[model samples]
Target: MQAEQAGALTVSDKPTTPMQMIAHAVANGAPVETMEKLLALQERWEAGEARKAFVAAMSAFKAKPPEIFRNRAVSHDRGKSTVFTHATLDNVCDALNVALASHGLSFRWETEQLEQGIIRVTCILTHAAGHSERTALQSTPDTSGSKNHVQAVGSTVTYLQRYTLLAATGIAVQGQDDDGAQGQKDQPITPEQVASLQAGLDETGADIQGFCKYMRVGALAEITMSGFGRAVAAIDAKRKKAGSA
Candidate 1:
């Protein structure tokens, strides 16, 4: 019987996976407790494989990051008109859907009213293999331009959804350069600063997406020079809290 089982296992030219082993054991009438152990083992192996697949897909997706152009403009109150452009929720979906699908990934959003006026939006990015990651951001409704209560909530939800998706995918908009208008003092952080912040995140095991949301930036590289000190301080606070814990 042992010889037959060994032969059965070795018959396949490809190396056997945990699932395959478990299946074979079940077919050979393994004991109930042994079957339970094999089942747990198989579950773990599948989860590990799914995680690895998710990482590989993400790496490939980032290799040629999608360029999302700003497609919408908003006008504030007053005689003066501000011509700032930003990528809308529709634009983000149109830009990322095809690319994400090609890499076996998809994203969805969940919204919750955390408080009377505050809304939390969570973006869940999932791989076809079953691994998933989430990025969430909370913000109050936008009452600018005299928007009504419903419009204000809708606007805030849309805004949070757009940002959460970008945060999860680590994507930034390639839009018209308004930095000249904002002044040199508002320039993005240097490469060295970005590297330092990245190292801090790694050491502290902080969520990059959450950090980006907290900093009001799409990505670490988009953090402004003026905000570098604050970013460092935030990381330091997290590190100290972790240490004390």
Candidate 2:
């Protein structure tokens, strides 16, 4: 009988010794060189299988279609408001950890404060079989808000960290909060905002598609009126950094 017919071990079986080789050679009545070749083939086959399994797991995770609750909002003057449908850091961590752990996939962030008060955020996704991918973004702090200096820095870090992770994973948020009954809804991106965004994109040589991904939308025209200011500021920051470089 062949060694495989006599219950040869698989990679997932956690074989700890050359015992399988010995048993296969003995059971199959095989020569030593043949046994060595068989062992090598098994190793290669196992590696290929591992890669396939990793891909399957990733596909399954992505197929589920993640959902993030829009639990926060900000009101502007004249009964105008801009609602942000974003996932909190804790919510993202909680939502992803269990699903990723099951697939031997995990993620982490590397943050750095560069000169001129720029913050760089990198999100790295790693798999158990040594495959990995990453996405990176840089931004200045949220100085326009009433936040103090530290809060401004913290806000930027938190925003970039969350977005980097989402962009890295290709996850999309699905919920939007529109609770506060208010005046006429805010309009979409205005002509002035579009001009500002286009100029910034030209100055920085940033791609419109990449900027949309960073903004978590399908197109530049989809950006809300409230988000246009922040988007313009982010692009200007990129332009400034490019100029300095």
Candidate 3:
């Protein structure tokens, strides 16, 4: 991730312990070497390298998120755009809604409600501009019922704390509360509050990249097309697993 991309992410103040780094890397099934690599890259960013090696690393981590996202109704998007889609868009929208809510910028969405019995799910986010973003998602059940032992809600909420930091820093537009502008006369999330949110995320043990994972929902929307990757991963994983078996 570039500093521009890193600028979009929130970094922690405390140096992460090797044990904690290993646990996070393993929990997500990430390569243990990944931590050292990412940390070194961050060091370059700090040292004014202007150009450290920017091998696409986020794609590798999103390959799997330690099942932390699955049970919490989250999904990995290896390489994709962050926009509305007919499939694979709900998670990002839901995550955005959650982030905005933290700053009193809540809005109503009907994607999940409408997709309850239908196979097609379209996630929507309505802004004050009298417009919205929509992503159509196709929900598929895991036939093997391999979902009983994944991470719990605690992990999901913790992950959210990490994301709130990114929301405030990446772009002022993202941090702006549309609700306040759209006739809901609420207070906007201030710059100071944004800084505080960043601080809080660090206090909770979020590593730099972990914070990126938390906020990548928007970056995925802003930087890559996410739905395409989700569809591909689902199909490929099923086919590869079946072939190996």
Pick the TM-score winner: 1
Per-residue CA lDDT of model 1 for 198-219, tens digit only, reads 8778989999999999999999
Look at candidate 3 and tell me the lDDT of residue 149. Answer: 23
Which runs of model 1 end up more than 4 angstroms from their true locations?
Answer: 1-15, 78-81, 176-245
Clashes of each: 0, 0, 16
Which number leads on lDDT? 1
Full candidate order by TM-score, most accurate first:
1, 2, 3
lDDT of 1 at 224: 89
- Estimate the overall C-alpha local distance difference test score of candidate 3: 0.34
Tens digits of per-residue lDDT, candidate 3, 1-245, equal: 58866665545523365555555666778875797776676555544322121111222222321111221222223253222211122443455455543432323323221122212233343333233333333322222223432332223222232323223222222233221122212223333323433443344443545444644533222212223224223333443456566
Worst 10 residues of 3 by lDDT: 50-59
lDDT score of residue 1 within candidate 2 = 58
Each prediction's RMSD over C-alphas, in Å, is 8.7, 9.7, 24.2
Candidate 1, 158: how far from true, in Å?
A: 0.5
lDDT ranking, best first:
1, 2, 3
TM-score of each: 0.66, 0.52, 0.21
lDDT of each: 0.80, 0.70, 0.34
Deviation (Å) of 151 in candidate 3: 17
